[model samples]
Target: MHFRHQTLSSALAMMASLACLSPLQAQTTGAQAPVISQSDAQHLTAAPSKLTLLTLLEAAWSRQPEAQSYTERLRAAESLRAASSAWTADSPAMLLQGKTDRPGSGAGSREVEVGVALPLWLPGQSQRATALSHAQILALQGSMKAQRLQLAGLVREGWWQTQRTQTELALAQTRVANAQQIALDVARRVKAGDLARADQHQAEGAVAQAESAVAEAQGAYEASLHALRGLTGLLDLSPDNLEATSEGDVSTPLPSADALASDAPSVDEHPLFAEAMAQQSMASAQADLAASSRRASPELTVLTTRSRGQTGDPYQQSITVGLRVPFGTGARADARQAEALAAAQEAQAMTLQMRARLQAQAASALARLRSAHTQWQATHRQAQLAQESKNFFDKSFRLGETDLPTRLRIEQEAVQAQKALSRARIDVSAAWSAWWQALGELPKP
Candidate 1:
């Protein structure tokens, strides 16, 4: 009976010792921890150190059709500008005429004429055309910037989505590891007759739940990575190369609230607003050109005629000059003028609409950034309290003062708090990206 009493005391002491071991210490026993498959392990590798937001933006921009066509569009606009600077409104024409009267008079009588006609630009037409071409160039430039900013928004969205899923996956993996360690301890205790078989089953259930979460988080992470790769056209992107700072490591600080509030760029400086204004200017120039061009371009003709009155008469040559002025067709001119005027008015309205929309977007983005920062601070505090609670429960369970269910609940709460904290960090980064986007700025290196 004394020997049996000593054995029970030794078993109790062993259970107590195991219970005091922290999760990290328990994880050090390689053979007891559940094995993570190679595929899951690969997805959990450390982030690539060299990748940056600017690099992703450049990669995504390279794949865009608009980015490729920007140079061509600029060249076309320059050609229009060059054409507008020429002396003639249209190309010069060469005219020729010849006549013979040999059949009726039996006389060698003929006339030949050759002339050149030069089309003249109406007053101020060239200047207006030049102005229109300049406006087109400005509009193209603004449009390109706008397109790049739009693409930046997409990259930011994909990048942050990837970060969010990756954080979840990391947390899920940690949970799995912790649950597996607990299960191993519970199984040992059950075999030693210190814990019931039902407790072992409960521990195993927790492990299974954690593993299920890993599967779900893994799927989400892979999907987010694929979307980012599609946008960037980069097939070899590392899953862990995140733009946002990692948990517990803030190497790069977030923008301050004062900076965010005071550094709002002017709405007129935005590409969308500039593009709209350029369009309005171009339309106004078009209207002016149309108003000046009330009639077809007049032509000045210079000719040379060679003729003979009779068969015996010597051939004669003479030079002639004339002007050809076309009459103004009031109906056609009126229609064209009215169309140009309508386009100008429409462009004016659009510019006003664009300005208002950009201002609203900027305001919305600022609000979101502020809200995200507030949430991040709250989550940080919640995570700290949850961690403290978990530590308390961990010690209590080790001393036999707490049950398995209570300890598990505390662990879960801690994990949930950690998840919220990670999400909040990512949200703050994403909001800043969105704020830059709203201001028509691309992601900086």
Candidate 2:
């Protein structure tokens, strides 16, 4: 028994390990193609503990006015769906009448009739009801999907902006340090009678300029952080809480246009598209129901009545059947049916149009990603070249082979090149974000 228990424990441990590792492995292998990761993972000063994308999504879902409005509409649709199952109700009704006439003879007559109007087997009622219920569910699903997509895009935008600003801030700080060192060197040279007072003034001016630029960049960074906080609803979001990671490869050549179009609307497998399709089905069902408005199912009703007369017993028992068929002056049924059909047709057309648009959107996103990646590569190379130039110019200036102004210019150019490279990296990230949004994916925390 002890050995068996040990075996069971070992099996459980293995299972737990598998469970933990499987998802991470899948993420790395592209088995589940999630959105790109940002730097949040590497720089987290503290675990969010209870914070998660789900928590944020839920909060937004609850607070958003559009989501709330749609929820009410969804409830109403559900009520209608329930009503469709049992469309007819039965009740007994009573009637009384009395009359007297003057002359040679007078007579009075009264009758009570209890009847019920029963709806017959509706031609398309059952199917229509089912379709409507399904459609409503789909519509709600779509609304939720749309809300989440919007939120995800916003979060990614904020995240990328914050990262970009932080990178710029670092570049700006480096510029300040370089300028300070140059000023110090010039000051020492002037004291040693190797450099003139004019050169010292130029170095001091460059230091002040670098300081101002750093201050501006810092302000921009702070503003970006503020935006990130607002968008994510996390007051404590900072560079310390983020991890830096790349979007890997966005440069895989895309498939042909024909191939892309072929899979266009197939993404209806997506929840939103599925919901839209369901709504179209419901509209079709509604059209059928309107066309068959004049039809009803058979009904059975029982009734008991009481009556009073001059010379007879006043109690009566009876069973009655009632039937009603609407005969409108115009083609009301036809008109209603036509309206539903039109709605369904419109929904179908929109779905097709959206599919075409989605394909175009995806293509555009991919193109941007390619452009951003190329830009990043070029800018990175340029920064390297600038660094080399700055190093050469610095040594030349120190050896009295180059003037102070020329060295300062080289340093400034190097700073610009570094800033450009940082900006390009951020652009690449933003392009990946756009691609993710287009594909209906969200970055995981």
Candidate 3:
């Protein structure tokens, strides 16, 4: 699987390089006709190039709002972390006061005071706050990783869907070419008076059917391509772009099912699991901080006062220091602590659920990959036998030993068998992609 995956990566890179060339360059090099229709080429040309898996993943990531906001989120977490390290629990405030008794005795009496109020952190609260900030950073990083993995799954699905449709289109085109050839042969036989006119009509009808199938396949292929382009913001309509080799075609021996089962990584390592764990840690830290913060922060006040009695009296300055301890609001603290604890418990439960889901997905994907391998082998044999049978029937038909209906039936069977083989090959690649997705692995460059 690894070898085949690398082969596919190389193929995609090569195709992307080719796609980067101008039409004039392609024409000068005498490139073959594009696999896609002219309309598709026109539509795709408007999109950016570089359609490799990694490029596609990047393009998709760039479009995500969360990805765009990640830097700001990180900055905010860092700011909180810095704040937690400060000596003061909150910002300091300045206080000013002035008093006069001019309306009363008229014997000038005035007082002016200035003060600074500094908030203090409760014991253990600062450390808990720092822990929460650290957890916030970890949680954000984990969330980003999980988000990228989710996007990788989307890209994988779109990539394989496009491959499947392209395969169908290619097979449909081949069927049309074969049908046209058969029609020509039937016409020749009719002209020589060796075959009836009805045979020619039947052959032409087959050609029409094949053409219709090609048209349908083309539409489906274009739609899938468009959807992929939407995700990756890239389009390379080159024929070689569809030539990625499937795992079934690789000569590398696959690992045994038991080996696959044992190769599964621990669920704790998964991005979703990590994100849930981080969230739980953050919530726990928050609960701890809340528990320590039983009341509003205590404030230390330092004041300087100047007073004068009568206009000629000289001012006096004195410094006074005082401490203000807020009364504890047990109900508010209880509510906040309860909320944080509840959040922690919820996050823990989510972590367990995420682990279970990942394990199940990994197991299911592995089983499907194994099944796809088996199916590919059977389909490969079926296609080979169908081809041989088609060859025999073609010879017998030309020799006037086989009826037109029998020849047509053989052709249909051959085409179906070829289609199945192509689909099976694509399925193998798709299964591998899905397995990687289940394991939270992104496509490598």
Candidate 4:
């Protein structure tokens, strides 16, 4: 009795799977996916811990050497800012002099002097240098933000792809199980003189094909999982609820094209846009500092000397002050200034380009989101129609009215419809993720 119930359960499961497998679903790439290694499969099954896309990005941030390098540059810029003041422009220099002479007559004469020379900051030079340092720091901050945003996009896409392959694998496995049941049932009927030998053979061939498809889907899924792990830098990885969420149904209809159009222009205000502006500011500040530094600072030296001679000779004292200023060469100074000015102009051009690029990115993302959502709706309807057709074929097969080959054909179509619907749902989520990323919704991580 227990064995009979188990067999009945398997048959019922197969019935449902065949009915759901529409042609569109069957047309997905799982059967044609590249075969991965056994080791890869083993590596993927080690579900270490639950992880979300956000957490993955944060982990990636800690491991980003480029971001760290930029941070170090920012630190150096801070030091430069501290050194931009007039007092820090150059260290005070001390001058010392000593002399001793033995005259043909009385005593040896000795004199010692100490003097300090200080470089004076030109009126606007200190402020200009400080501003330059500040601008560099701002640029570094903006660059870090852009780097992180780019990293987040890669990881996000990887995560969604993993979900895609994983879901497809399950669907493939279901098809394999259903085909096996059909083969078994047909073989039993043939032995009992209820079905023809040709029917049994055809059903057996389907099971073989379905098993091969399962292997391909498994390999593709494991490969995708490995890629996700490589990007996140985790010792071990696990997928969270992204697959479920992405494949799940939406409660409301997607937005209209006009709404998306209205929202597209706002992505220019993303953090990446700010980064380009910061780069421009840094270049402009560099130009300002170069112009200010053209005028060299003057040095002032103050000295005092005292001498003693004979047993009770009065002490002799002298004081001296000197000022020096060196003129800058015109060719070199002008060239230096021109270089900075050119950099400023280049940076300004890049800033404008970045704004346009971001706006375009946002528009593209919005369009994809809408298209995917619409595809999901259309494919879902196809799936339902396929299901109804599969139901009619299922009834016909059970009554021995439809041959095994005809029934198998209908089942394959139903599976394709299932696959198409699943892919459409996954694409919708993927499009939404992309839209958010393009708009610089990637936070600090």
TM-score (all chains, Cα) for each model: 0.83, 0.74, 0.86, 0.81
TM-score of candidate 1 relative to the true fold:
0.83
Best by lDDT: 3
Error of 4 at 365 (Å): 0.7
In terms of lDDT, the poorest run of 10 residues in model 2 is: 26-35
Instruction: Report the C-alpha displacement of residue 424, candidate 3, in angstroms.
Output: 0.7
Order of quality (TM-score): 3, 1, 4, 2
Tell me how many residue pairs clash in candidate 3.
0
Candidate 1: residue 195 lDDT (0-100): 77
Whole-structure CA lDDT of model 3: 0.78
Which runs of model 2 end up more than 4 angstroms from their true locations? Answer: 1-78, 87-121, 245-266, 270-272, 294-303, 329-334
In candidate 1, which residue pairs get closer than 3 Å at backbone N, Cα or C atoms, i.e. clash?
none
Greater lDDT among 1 and 3 belongs to: 3
Candidate ranking under lDDT, highest first, comes to 3, 1, 4, 2
Worst lDDT window (10 residues) for model 4?
239-248
RMSD of 1: 7.5
> Model 3, poorest ten-residue lDDT window?
23-32
Write candidate 2's Cα lDDT for 6-87 as tens digits.
5434534543443454322322221221122355423222224354444444444454577667767878777766766665
Steric clash count of candidate 4? 18
State the lDDT of candidate 1 residue by residue for 1-445, as single tens digits. 3553454456455445545654333222211222345565554333345556787788888878999988998999999999889998888999999888876664778889999998988889889889889988988888888888888888888888988887787777678766766666666666778778888779878978987997787778778876776678655555324545322222335445654346777888888888888889989989998998989988989999999987889889999999889999899999999999999999999999998899889878878877887898999999999999998988887666888888789989999999999999888878877878888887665
